[model samples]
Target: MDSDVDESLDIIITNVVATFRTRCHLNLRTIALKGINVIYKPEVGKVLMKIRKPNISASIWSSGKIICTGAASENDAKVGARRLARYLQKLGFKVSFSDFKVVNVLAVCSMPFAIHLIDFTKNNRSIASYEPELHPAATYRIKHLKATIQVFSTGSITITGPNVQNVAAAVETIYPLLFECKKFLGK
Candidate 1:
């Protein structure tokens, strides 16, 4: 039954956001001028750097904090962060890679059946909030997993959690509640 559920749910990780520190100050202006595929936004006080291998984008701050997003997996996120730090090292900064952490993971999965959003919200009012006017999807949060699951009428779910394990656990935790509100196709 667990295998069946896992096969059906098919959670696909779409994005992983991770952050790391260089442990040294970075000169944004110089990086923008010398770095490849870099965009320096002075107003935002960060430089955006893009790498092709892992297809990730990183926001680098002068304070030496870098946030990497768009990685498909946690390992990719770590690799992307390391690559970004190496780029800074080549630019003459005393870059020391430390404090690398995966802060958020976003995944998408589709239920085998359509979801009755209103019914689901009604059944789990305390944890689920539905506002059709403001958003099309009902937002549900799992406190223990520290994950947020967004359910749409089309049976698509978007999950954001601290890590991949938590995201997957959240799907399992919410499945029964969602099954109760599953739409019946036949009249």
Candidate 2:
């Protein structure tokens, strides 16, 4: 019975993820670039990126606020945010970034909300250590590295005290990686 229940849950989650992917496919593909980096700065709860070519830059602050510094237009900035949010979701990270708020479509379009999480495991141990409190309509768990990455689908991610700091620090440390991706995209 337990196994059956677990299997059912898996199927449900898979279906939800698939639906999200399909809905967002077009926008995601259109804005998908070859190179991009995601940096974590836990101290400030911020993630910053430096993109070349088109010279795009942006940041996700701990307060659940997203800012675009070098986008060509408001549309560009929104698209960048949506792409980042979607990619994070695909990677198994729970994201609260709102697609409707960030993405503005002139015509009728469908954008699915999705989040993915990848657990870090090695040496017979998991890395994620933080456990966040339960929130409505959000799902999360701890992975490897004492790092717990939680994402929200309602366009707002809630972070507590220490976890917020950790996220910010991680974003800063990983900024360079995002730049490398940008370079690869030739943008």
- Which one is best on lDDT? 1
Q: What is the lDDT of residue 18 in candidate 2?
A: 6
Q: For each candidate, what TM-score against the reference?
A: 0.95, 0.29
- Maximum-TM-score candidate: 1
| lDDT measured at residue 158 in model 2 versus the true structure, 0 to 100 | 25
* Model 1 poorest 10 in a row by lDDT: 1-10
Error of 1 at 101 (Å): 0.8
The TM-score obtained by model 2 is: 0.29
For all candidates in order, the CA lDDT equals: 0.93, 0.34
Candidate 2 lDDT at 121 equals 16
lDDT of 1 by residue, 14-61 (tens): 999999999999999999999999998999899999999798999999
Clashing pairs for model 1 are none
Position 128, candidate 2: lDDT: 28
lDDT of 1 at 29: 99
